[model samples]
Target: MDAAVSLLRRAEAAIPSGRGASALFAMLRPDDDPQSWRSTLNNDGAPYQIAVTDAGADASVRLIVDPFRLGRDEADRVGRNLAAFDRIAHRCSSAAAARCRRFMAALAPSFEEGCERRSGDIWLAALPGAAGVGIYVTARGRAPQIQCTRLIAAAGLDHHRAAIAAIHAYGAVEAYSIQGSRCDDLAINIYWKPRGGTPLPPAINFEPPALSPGSPPTALARAPLGAMTLCSTFAVLGSGRGSKIDLCNHCLGLDLAASLEILGRFCDLSPAFVRGAGDMLAGEDAEIAFLGVRVRPSGDRAYLYLKPAASACQSVPHLVEGATCR
Candidate 1:
C-alpha cells in the first residue's frame, strides 16, 4: 500500500501540467467508489475522504484532501487535465457521455445562434474530477469567462447555481450527472435561461425510436460513417476476354428495369454497367433486355458472397473481380 501510494505520486508528477487532474482526482479517492466519491465531493464542495483498513493488523488510516485552497498553478493543471478527460470519456459508451453528445448535437444550431448573438466562444470540457461535465463561454478579450461545472460537489450548490445562471444568461444548455458510491441514484440537471433573458433557440428535436416494453433502451446510434450499406444484387458484364471494370457495390444491384428507372431519375446511365445477360437479351429480343444481376453482401461485419451469374457459363469472361471475392 505504501509502495502503491508512492507509485501514484510518481505517476502524478510525470503527467503534463494540464493532463493530470483526472489522475490526481482518482488518487485522492483511491479505493473509493468512483461514482460515489465524485458525487459526494461535488455535492459537499469538500475534500475527498480516503479510508484505508487492515483487518489483520487492526490498523486504518483516514485522510481528507481539502479542495478550497489549491495553488493557482495546480488548479490550472487540474483544469486542463479535466478537459482532456472529458474528450476521452466521450469515446466511451457511458450513459452520461451519450446524453451529453445527444444534447450537444441537438442544440448545435442554437449554440451557433447564441455564439453569434453574444459574440462569444462556447467551449465544452469533461470534468471527470467533478464527476460530471462543464461548459464555458467567453467573449473575445473577456477575462474570467462565464463557466458552469455541473455534477460538482453537492456542498457547492451556491457555486453550482451561480455557474448555471451564468451559462443560461449566455444562452447555453447543459446536462450532467452525479452518482457516487454512497448514492445509487443518478442525479441529472439541465439548465437554461428564462424568457426575459437572452433565450436559447428551441432545442432541435431528434427523438430516437422507443424500445418495446420488455426491452432495454436501444444503444445510442453509432457515428455516421461507422456503417455502410452494400447492394445484394449485381450482374457481371464482359466478353470472353479480360474487359475488367469495377463498380461500387451499391451499383451492382440494379436490374435492367431498375437501371432504366435510375437512368430516368439521373438522366445518365453511363455510371451503370450493362449486365452480361443484357447482351444476350440485346441480341435475342431488342424490346426485352435481360440484365444479369449479381447478388452478394459486403461489409465489415460479415462474409457474404454470391456466385457471379456469369460463373455458371464456363465460356464467360472475367469482367469485374473483387479482391475479396478471389
Candidate 2:
C-alpha cells in the first residue's frame, strides 16, 4: 500500500469514523487499489479532500470523503471503513456525540428528498476533539427548495436558535462545520465561497473584494488568483451572541513557483519532497490544478486538493474531468 493509504488504514483501524471535514477516513478493502481513490480524495472541485496535518509518528490525516463508492457492497464497505474513524485521536462519548450522530441520521431523508442535485458537501475539520457534520443552508437556483437550516430544523438541531439565526445571517457562505466532541461547543464554520453545478476544472482567477480604505496589504485583506475564490472564506465559531470569528482568510490556488512564495510566508514547508503536501503527482508534468492554502492568525494552512491527471484518457471520469451535477 502507498504510505498515505497505509497511514489512512492505520488510522482507520486505530478507531472508527471521523472529525468534521478532514478526519473522515476509512479502511480500504483488499481488492481496492488505493491509488485509484487518491484522485477522488484530493479533488477540490468535488469538495472531497484528504488533508494531512503535522508530520512523522504524530502526523494525523483527515479527509471529508465522498460516499459514492462504485461497487454493490460499497455501502457496507463504506460503513465498515467509516467506522474506523470514530476514535482516531480522540473519542466522543458524551451525549453530544450521540446527539450529533442522531442529527446526521435525521438529515439523510431530507438530503434524498431534495429536488435539487448539489454535489455532496461532506465537511471534515482537523481542529482536534471536534467531530460533526455540516451542510450548505442557502437557497440556490430557480425556486430552490432544500436548504441546510431547514434540514437542521427538521432534524431538531434548530433548538440552538442561535445557530439557526447565525445561518440566516451568513446565507452566502459555502460550507459549515459543527464541533461535536466538545459537548458544549456549538460552533459552526461557514466556507465563504460557493461551488455548484457539477465539477468545473479550476481556472486561475483571483477576484478580491474591495477592501476598506485603511485595509492592509495581507491575505486577509486581499486575495490571490486561481485560488478557491476571491470572496473571503470564513469560519463562524459560535452562534448569535456567542458567535465570533474563529479563522478567516482567502484560500489561494497557485502554480508551483507561486505556491512556494506564499507557502514560506505561512509555514516552513521545504520546497522539495515535503511529506503530507497536497500536491500528489506521479509524473513530473502533472500540472497542479490547485495548490490550496489558507492564511490565518494561528498560521497558514494548506490542502493538496485536486487529483493528478490520469493517462491521457478522453475522460478519466473524475470530477475535474468534467461531469454534470447528478
Candidate 3:
C-alpha cells in the first residue's frame, strides 16, 4: 500500500510541467484472493481503469502518461523513454541489492538520453527486492557532454558527502541542506555548472562565514557557481514506518525519493505514508527564498563567497564584527 502511494505521488511530481498532462494508474492483484491484495488508482476525474492477474500480490504498478501534454515530437520521445522504464519497473519492484546496481547501470543509457535532451531533471524510483528503494537523478549542464554517475548514500547527510564532492568536482554553485520539522529527514539539493564554465553572475570579492562548533545555520556556503545549504531536520523516522510526506511539492518529491532510496539501501521496507497534498512537477525552479543573505557571489580563489544569515550572525557573535551581506 505504501509503495503504491509513493509511486502515485512520484508520478504526479515526476514531470516538469503539469499543463495538459494526465496519468493512468493501474495495479494487479490475484482474483482468487482479492482481499489479500488490493490496489487504488486515484485519478482526478479522468476515466481510466485496468486489471491484470499476476503474482505481484505484494504490489504491481503501471503508469500511462498522456502524450498530448508534451506535443507530438516531444510526446513521442517521452513515450519511448517511459516505455523502456515500464519494461523494467516490475523487475525493479523485486530485485535484490546486486540486481539493483545492475538495473541502475543498465538504465544509465536511457537517463543519459534524458539528460541530453535536458529540458528538465529526470528522476525515477523503484523497490529492489522488496527490501530497499533506488532513485536515479540525472541532470545535464553540470558535466556537459559527459555522463557521470555518483553513488549517493542516505546515511552521509551531515558531512554533505556526495553533494560536496559533486560541487567541487563539477563546479556546482547551488547546493543546500534542509532540516525540516514536518519530516525527520535531510534534503541536500544542488545545482551545477559544467566543467570549465564561467561564473554566471560575473564576480565579486567576499569570504564564507565560519560556522560555530555546535550546530550550523540554515545557509551553508556560497560559491562562484552559486550558494549551498546543508539543512538539518529535527524529525527522525526510525525504521521508516509511518513516515509522512508532508512537505512542499518540489521538496516533497525530493525528500520522499531520497529517503526511500536510502531506506531501500538498508533493505528496510517499513510502512510509510505521504500525508500532504501536492502537484505534478512544475517547470519552474524550486523556491529557495528561505536562505536569505546566506548566498553571495565572488570571483575569488574559491570562485564564490558566503555569509551568515541575520539569525546566524546574531547567534554567533563573532560573525557580526566583520560580516557584510553586500
- Whose TM-score is greatest here? 2
Q: Across residues 69-128, which tens digit of lDDT does each residue of candidate 3 receive?
A: 121354454554344344335442332333333433432334344434322222332222
Poorly placed runs, candidate 1 (over 4 Å): 1-19, 22-86, 90-93, 108-115, 118-121, 127-132, 135-186, 190-326
lDDT (CA) for every model shown? Answer: 0.26, 0.35, 0.26
Count of clashing residue pairs in every prediction: 17, 21, 20
Off by over 4 Å in 2: 1-48, 54-60, 69-91, 94-96, 106-171, 179-181, 184-187, 194-253, 266-303, 306-320, 323-326
lDDT of 1 by residue, 82-176 (tens): 44335444433376454444333332223333323321122333322234343322222222123233222221334234433444444333222
Best candidate according to lDDT: 2
Give the 10-residue window scoring lowest on summed lDDT in candidate 2: 241-250
Cα lDDT tens digits for candidate 2, 77-108: 33432343333324453555554444443333
TM-score of each: 0.20, 0.48, 0.19
Tell me the lDDT of model 2 at 199: 33
